[model samples]
Target: MREDFLHYVWQQQYFDKQNLLTETGELLTVLHPGFHNTDAGPDFLNARLQLGEVEWNGAVEIHLRASDWHRHQHQTDARYDQVILHVVLTADQPVLRTDGTPIPTLALAGRIPLEMLHTYQQLQTAPPATLPCAPFLTKIPEITRLSMVDRALLERMERKSATVQLLHQQLDNDWEATAWHVLAAGFGFRKNTEPLARLAKALPLRILRRHRHNLLQTEALLFGQAGFLSAANEKAEDIADEYVQMLRAEYEFLRHKYDLENTGLKEHEWNFLRMRPANFPTARLAQLAALLHARPLLFDALLSAQNVAVLEQFFSNESSVYWRTHYRPGRAGKVPALGRSSMHLLITNVVVPLRVAYARSVGQTEQVEAALQLLTELPAEKNHVLALYEGLPFTHRTAADSQGLLMLATAYCQPLRCVECAIGSRILRHNSALK
Candidate 1:
């Protein structure tokens, strides 16, 4: 069928290798199968084979049909000149190399093992309405399942940390606030993550580094950058005044820096229906910016600092005093308070990923456990990743696994590549015989 299936068969040597023959009735002896090249040019590179009494060394290419060589236009390319063999499922035409020399052809349809063929056919077939191997996976040893999950978790962490390293590279190694931005984006959860991360990415860390003392200005810049300067329509004069001058300066500076058309707020489209001010992008960014400005080197302290008491002491009263009573610029709200949600967000997204990233940079596994413990000190998170796994019976629910799940979802699950997932792959293989 597909060339990938043929590749799987050939690469695995599922076909009979003991005795082989060419379509021209010449006895073929295999010396090498060649390297499977995923890059440009031939399918397989540098093969060695014996054609009857003659021995040759070159490349091997495969096709579903012999006529595919010309169909794919490889005959005009000099790259196919070195192809010593052309293995196909069907030989419909005589294939010639770029030099007009006849290329050796081998049809593998009758040469492959019947048992392997049957197994492959059965595994790839349409299921009988149910999943392929549900009963069998349940019978697998619990230890194996646990080991597999653990491996998956570690693999996920390693992969996520690579992203951190790339971000650190982009930031020129101000790993501290990069961690904060990452965690802050996670705070909005999936619905608003991209927008939040965009705010973080758009607002440079240099701005935070410079005005790390003025929390209001910090928030103003962050919030204003996200197109949230709506002080004109606000009912509270004090709230409007708080950001008026800062918003003016921000607009002027932003116009020069970003070269934008308009920075003025359009009052009609702004939505403040049921969302509390603390959750509003304006108030939250301001509060978060204030917090970051208050503690510029917070990430460094978080990494080395072991105790939860220490972190709490550093972050407990870190939000803007205004945020305690107001969620937006001027809605007259008193119920809002800087919740542990942000703290937990910082820990889960920034601190944990940073530690994991640092661990990878230094090749230390201990930081993973340390990062996990830090997240556990905070409350449990509610995200798409956690929600998906919430219904599944998990024996281990450590912060490490939670962080791993976050990485897994953001990195893998959300994109729907479950087939490549350990659990999904395991489930697939378990049902392979019944497919």
Candidate 2:
């Protein structure tokens, strides 16, 4: 009933060609149905047909009604001049092209088999997939799977690079190393990300450079300012012993100066559930703060990191002495170890972005190549996109191929418009050939 169904039937050869006749019962022969152009003009292009032994070679156009030629304004356009045939579902009125010559018309309503219509209707009414190509992925080749996986890992790095570029804009292009650390710290999300970022942002490089000798005091100041003290909240001591008061005064001054409001940050209500003490944001920040206190030039080393292995090494041995013994000040939870997600975050936010930004800062932008190479060090993610590829014969083992799978999943497989996919066309054609 729909015009698209007519197009499908025409393109799929759903009608019998033998013993074909015109409405007036003249013998008809189709030489070429013509190319089905999706754009404007005739529905089919450059057709060759024979009507009553006079071979006609021109374009073919289709419509629901023979009068659509006028309805669509083809009569006013010269592009319809070559239209030799106007095939319609019903021939209600004689149609003509711009030249005023009558185009040979055929009503296809009576020519196509009822069985073909039923088959097409049933096929179109089938269920859709959650992941576009979920149903048909099993038919894909294994080699295609690997290619898609590798692409996904690279896709993550590319996304990380984009995120870093935004941070540069935020920091006014001031501190690439500090910006990378802040953004990388942000990925800890609502769970522990806020306090960590606050600790890093609060302690400026100028302060660290001024009191590089008092590393523990600097660490205690950063940690204390974040309200991480476990020595009870009832003390009213000097500015030095009153770590909370000193840090609070500093943070309040900074907040007003920077026009900032606290975000996802709380002294209490931290996520201790399913988290080890060492991995706790409070503990990690305290540890990182101490390490920064001890080695004021650590950011410089990170800026000079050459590869993923080097970056991994920096993160691997980056913990402080306090983190080794304590998880929290008041709480006596067991110390927890850092996980792989943290490592992934370090590579994505710190290592990759810092490299790209550092390269652009000094006019050596070739670091993009090195950044992308380091991204290949990680494995591809396992998400819905990968699940779709799993349905195919493809066995995804790399990040790049997983990204390709995501591209394929979003654009093709997940939509359930299988007939529109290249693989669907192949499957349909193969089935028809077998039949």
Candidate 3:
């Protein structure tokens, strides 16, 4: 009984259209139902209709009851004066203009098929589930599902591109600096993105570039800025380590040289509660330091990377010698380098978005296409959400497919927006027709 259902029914011509008439028994012919208005004013605008022997063109308004016009006080609003038709589910009262002229009314309560009503009701009243359309997903055509997923993937990319655009603006359109911040955030993964981004912001690329020639200086700057170089916080064993003492000394000199001020991101800001040893913040920062030292022109090289293999190679550099067998400064143990899975995540989240933003800013259509092509070349992501759609009609073979499924789960299914989703719309239409 929601007004959105009525809008859907009218927009799709789901109700019986034969021998249409108004409540006063005048023949009504809809030349055009008008575009549905999502903004303020009428429910529809620029409608062309035939009222008996006369042709009319204006806005159209719909309500669950004709009396709702008065309840909503549209009679006093100047915006509703041009409405040529007031279509309601029930005509409980007459709607008039300011000049005392009666507006044509159409009641669709009896015209809508009982089957359509039943189908819509079932979708709305169904018990809570992962996806309202999950039961009927297989019933939809494969082509229809594929088309929807394609659109969803683009939608997700567009949203991510917007974030990059905002960062670009904040950095005064500096692509390199924006990419640095973005890459730093990506290295943090999901658990510590904010702290890593803060670290990047506190220590600009210019500062890091100055010390790029010496990998130890670059590591000291990054680790020092992250508040991880404090000797007081380290264990006695770590304090006795020669490498830790060297970094502490190097950071002390750099801190004084740059006149840097800590941005209050202490060691506690990083989350290490249940994360794998390889994904520890200390290890990630070491990898980031190595990347900075190896690729002085990180953004430039990424932009010129011809394919996924080249991009993977760009991030394949190993960390410093001290990090080869340690996840943290105080913890010394054999730890693996950045794995392929982590690299895939960085490419998907950081590299692609950065490329898309830069390409869009510089008006390079081919680069944008190349960035999206990289995602299609990469393997699909495995996550809890993807597990929900494991045996669905579509195959998630690449990052593009997984991204599409993520968008579908979050934007469509999670919100129960069945009417707006293509798969849900098709299911509803089929069920309604069957009824």
Candidate 4:
């Protein structure tokens, strides 16, 4: 069994604790199992324990084997000196603190219920191809599954918020710039997120705002900064297009005007191979330019969206007059403006995260709630990841539910971190059957 299972057993007091004794034959009475510590130092902190006639309050460290104490080199770390006890599944060897004091040891090999261990072992042996906890999914209470998914969703939003907050701090607490960078990265969808983020950072929002009133100039700045308007990037056929030539000339003048000649990206930094024409970086850049030109207060517009319809309308911009017929730089292809699914994705990724980040920055609780409320109004996302949980009762009704399941699948299940999952924890505790 894994070390974490031992931790769970100890935390929940699932193991037999009557007549407990340390390896040194001291009567060990656990007054308090202590708080489970996730950070560095000990596994459990502030433990209140009774060793014989002595009452000790300190940390408790756990390991699969007693030898793990030295294997982890806790003997040298002074932080572990506070360890009042070393609780292990097997007490094969003794341990000492940095001061050479022998820490009391409690072996739990036979103390824990055999049934629980067997069940957890069964889950660990499940086939990896399917969902990590697929077999025991139905056995878990529906409410429990829902609650865990909600937690996963919150975790995802918070994680995204952290990213946005970091960007906000890096941009010197500028919400608009943070929104711009996040939106630019989100517009990349997945394939070109890094380059898109880099492109956004290189071309500041102020520069884009300066030229937003003129659509051509706005597109020129974005396309130019993204490395698309450079001569080395231009295809032989695209060189003769009037719009392309005009854009190139406009970007050169704008670049020189702004003294940004050296801050442009290479054309090869973008990804276009095997992707649909509509979702191409060039097309996405065009849509971003349109959105920037349409709304000067873009972050405000996103926040003030009353419902999904209004939020969706924000992304309904049809780019430019020329883009109505062309999808890429010089490509002769007709692609629709952000499709319904694509718009929904933008709301889910860009709008939701951006709103949450903004709300948290100003410490507005209602605003944060309102930001999350938008997801409940939007349609559920349909993709392979959600499909993995097809038969489960995750509902997948709205973007919120889908978002929860997506977070669970992408973060917890795929990584085989079942021991840390609520559903998996339940299955281990109850020995739920597999499909």
Best by TM-score: 4
What's the TM for model 2? 0.53
Q: Per-residue lDDT for 319-426 in model 2, tens only? A: 444455556543434554445666665665566666666566567767766765665676766865466455446545544445556655664455444455455444
Q: Which ten residues in a row have the lowest lDDT in candidate 3?
A: 125-134
**Tens-digit per-residue lDDT, 21-66, candidate 1:** 8888788987878889989898988888999999999999899999
- Give TM per candidate: 0.69, 0.53, 0.88, 0.96
What TM-score does model 4 achieve against the real structure? Answer: 0.96
What's the CA RMSD for each of the models?
5.6, 9.1, 3.1, 2.3
Name the candidate, 2 or 4, with the larger lDDT value. Answer: 4
Give the CA lDDT, 0 to 100, for residue 89 in model 3: 96
Cα error, residue 38 of model 3, in Å, equals: 4.7
**For residue 29, what is the lDDT in candidate 1?**
83
Q: How far is 53's C-alpha from truth in model 1 (Å)?
A: 4.6
lDDT of 1: 0.65
